[model samples]
Target chain A: MRNQHQNGTNHQVRHYQALSPAQINRFGLVELGSSGPLYRFCVRLFGILALLGIVGFMMRVASSGFSDRAAWGYYVATVVFIFVTFQAAPTVAFAIRAAKGHWRRPVSRIAELFAVVGVLNLILLLPVLFLIPPITGGRKTFWFELHWLLPFSAPGFFLFFGMLALVVCGLCLLYLSALPDFAAARDAKGGIYTGLARGWVGSQRQWKMLKSGLNLLGAFYLMTFVLVTTLFAWDVSETLVPGWKDAIYPAFHSITGLQGAIASTILALGIARKFGGLKNHLHMEQFWGLSKPLLATSLLWFYMGWSTFLTYWYGRTLAEQHVLQLLMFGPYFTVFVMSFLLKFLIPLLFLIWNRVRMSIMGPVLIALSILTGDIFEMVRLYVGPFTITEVGHEMTHVPAAHLPDFADILIIAGAISGAIFIYLVSSKIIPRISLWDMKEGMLLTRVQSFHRAEVLVIGKPE
Target chain B: MVDKSILGLFKDPDSTADAVDSLRKAGFGNHTFDILSGVPYPEGTFGEHGPGHKLFVFPLIGAICGFSVALLLTLGTQVSFPMVQGGKPLIAIPPMMVIMYEGTMLGAILFTVLGVLFESRLPRPGVGLYDTRITEGFIGLLVSCPEEKIGAAEQALRGAGAEDIKTESASGGGR
Candidate 1:
């Protein structure tokens, strides 16, 4: 409703009420402390579900044990689902901030807050490290049978440490970005904020270091994210399915992560605006701004998926056919159809329309669709390979799809709920809206009259 | 003579910028004063000299060190154990490249964090001559001058419409 169309130009006038620095600080700090009944209920609900997820994890361990790799298919899918969705969320902040997109100011903190979910994912990943067969088992691995002096499993070692690096980098990124806000809180509340602030004085040197640090860390986070995704895709999924040797799989998996990151950010933005008392900060522009990328990634998701599918479709080798059957046409055919439709077909059809892409609810609904599709997609990619017991260069047989039991269902729900729980708790600690960024945006933006209509003028300071 | 740290708080950014100009006109050098705000105002918004940092150097150094270390580890392991698999050389370049890449990134990331902390002078033992109001939309122009020049610094700050001024003795330190 705040968006106004200008004559001849397609630029819609974005209505922004400039909050003063004092006002920005006050609102941000107050929001950090204020939990409405709905907020409290959601927190408690997610908390219980998160505990249930732990119980579900234990139930899974007790029943299947670490040795039964096939039984843990759903659990592996759940972990990768969290990785590709929630753990990938901070990259949204990193990307937008690196691009210097002014519209990303309010959304950056929301995306970065998802870094807290990495702690949950890291813990979830521990069991999965054990789930993966060691590289010494004569399986195809990146390690290439070089397991001479290594005491532990090579893939597990690299995967665990790679994930550890990513998680630590994500947390550091979150903390450094929030340091100034912590200082603001220290000034206002002065209890825990004092310690968190770490005596930030906002000197010119500190600000400079902060900016440079954010850029450097953002770049490192992205590189690390891609590498870790590649490792996970190759070691965990691709190697398990014999003759499924597509070099593009890791790249495709990373693309899926990028898409999931955008979807998760958009969905969280919608929820924050609708329920988290941030309606004033989040608006149509944020949704519309993100929708373009959502559309691009959707098309990209199809592009990558189709490229890989076309290879198997034409190769027609017995191994390729079995690989396809295992993943696409065999036991998981329905799941594949659903994932393909939701992830690609529906998004491409819906997002192609400008009306749908520009509206707030349209993109939010599409993001939800993509997120749901991601779960099925993860299941298709991960669970199917996990069901395969073969360890050679060719697949002799396509195994039947493994269906999820009660514990598997609980694990899926609990992992998602646990991620949300961590994000909610983190929001209370770090201001959901980036206070300093908002204030800086206020300094750099203003509305000026242009030819009988007011247009927003933004200052790009080097 | 012991120096004094004087903090001039201004409600308006224009006044803060004016205070910078006034401090210069009052014979205070650029290094004697620095601007502090909750917002990261662009460099030179207050007409102050932009400070140079060695942050970029840190990552380069880290990368070199990391690459060197990774090179030694990968090359050393392959040379010591000299095993040929699938007709590939003992030191397989592709797998070594992956580990080396991770190593380089790890080094760059670790050093970048350390560089930021070191350059920012964070976790400072004490926050001297600070006002909470600076975080509440106020601008602080902190000036370090000899004890005798504190009066003139106060004059310059007040002349530029500083809302409040605080002064404390210091044993000659630069922020």
Candidate 2:
């Protein structure tokens, strides 16, 4: 839609024609049903990789039994990497939706779709749970001596249940958010969508309930995400390393998760816009809007990391030094550098620019950088600690960084690919764009002439 | 004097709002009619009464139940065992707080989901006086009325530019 210049001014105003509700519903349903050859090929490719991940996992398990925690360093790192990145992606949906950012309407579904990956991560977490020794082994753990009294292993027990709660909540959030779209498909085609929709009729009461449910679930999902992150950080990484008791570490891990979540969401949005036939729906506004948070999280990542590093640096004791060497300067120095630059330094330097932050590719590129850094960061955090087998209250020695082998590489690539594979399959079932959200956005927004330029007027209802 | 359900479809929101206003003017109370749309127009867009819900109560109740159960499990287990590990008391409040927190959240989340389902009256046996076009940008104003007032309801709906009207018996099939 275009508006002509009429007041003897040479300024041309461009008006956006929002997609009608019917068009949104029809297009979303059609897109869900029909996948291009390229999309199908990608899905198959990822499916093969996912199978390879299973093969890699089995190879590792067979070759090096669960007794050797050192050998499974990369394995645990890969699982945590997935947990913090793809599994954390839904947090962006909850955060943006809770903040009532209208630009998030198109992006929220992209973020929420990543919840399906939580199932895969939950399965990956089980073996890692077994890998963690009980808290009774004279190791310093949050559980103290609870392992002696409890029937099961304390760390593993808590980690498994915490992760399970997060996964279930995430799935519920995704399901509830997609209910309206299912009803749309049911209205259009009347097959399995009917059952999935479960008799949703868009009545006022249903809408009210749906809205309330989303808000509550989103809040719960966010809290559970933080709790789960804390569990992973403390039990898997912190408690594993003797004398590595930094209170800020769990918060640091959460910051990493939040950063990784935004990065993954941005990357997925870019891919969807570029290759997933969503060019018309996702615009530069979404990218620019997300870039602000990406920049903020980058700064927060540096802040948290620096705070932890500073504490260890100032302590200057042998125990603190060993802890620092294990995580930062000792064997995984290269990984720490790479993670620092990509996750914090590089994003900070580039995303600070107005020109870079305003473009579609800029934020996407930064997101890519952050995700690459997340892999290195996870390795540095999880693998280094896994190498230390000492169960004392203080570090006796800082072990060398355990490099990943062929199986570990497969596990890493396969895990990431498996997540993508699950996402692709899910996108087929659920409409990629939130159809109802788009329609509601269209209803709330109007483009009108403000002076010489056409500006959008958005309605914010209480 | 049987009750009948009537659904008046409107292409645009303004007409839907006008239909609501017209129904009220023609002796139909707010409780007798409801608006359905593909999009969630903000409450009161049609000047209809906002329905109250008990959704918030579910989470509160869940939190209380979860906290109570967690307190019992944590305190009961510790006191039953009664071993001081790190120069601490038999019942450690700090460590138990984690489990308690998890229990509280889990309870709240599960009950909130159930609350949504219950309050929404999901999985209804039948969708009465419904039109599929309502999901395709059309708005439906559904009215439940006595058989004697069907003509007046139809007149009010038509006066406000209803695109189409469908009526169904109280027992539930739309035609």
Each candidate: RMSD: 2.7, 2.4
Clashing pairs in 1: none
**What tens digits encode model 1's per-residue C-alpha lDDT throughout A61-117?**
899888889889988888899999888989999999988988899999999988888
The global Cα lDDT (0 to 1) of model 1 is: 0.86
Candidate 1, backbone clash total? 0
State the interface C-alpha RMSD of candidate 1.
1.6
Write the residue-wise lDDT of candidate 2 on A1-462 in tens digits. 334434533221232456778888878899646989999999999999989988999899999989888889998998999988899999999889989988889899999999999999988888887788776657776664456544546777777877877888898899999999998898898888878988888989899999899999999888988998999898888988888889898999999999999999999999999999887777777888899999998999999989999999999799999988988999999999999999999999999999998888999999999999999999999999888889887887888778899899889889889999999999999998899998999899876767765667789995
Could you give the DockQ of candidate 2? Answer: 0.70
Off by over 4 Å in 1: A1-14, A144-151, B79-84, B169-175
Q: Residue A109 in candidate 1 has what lDDT? A: 94
Worst 10 residues of 1 chain A by lDDT: A1-10
Q: Which lDDT tens digits does candidate 2 get at residues B64-169?
A: 8877877887788777767565566777788788888888888888888889999988876556678899899999999989988989999999999999988885
Q: Native-contact recovery for every candidate?
A: 0.77, 0.73
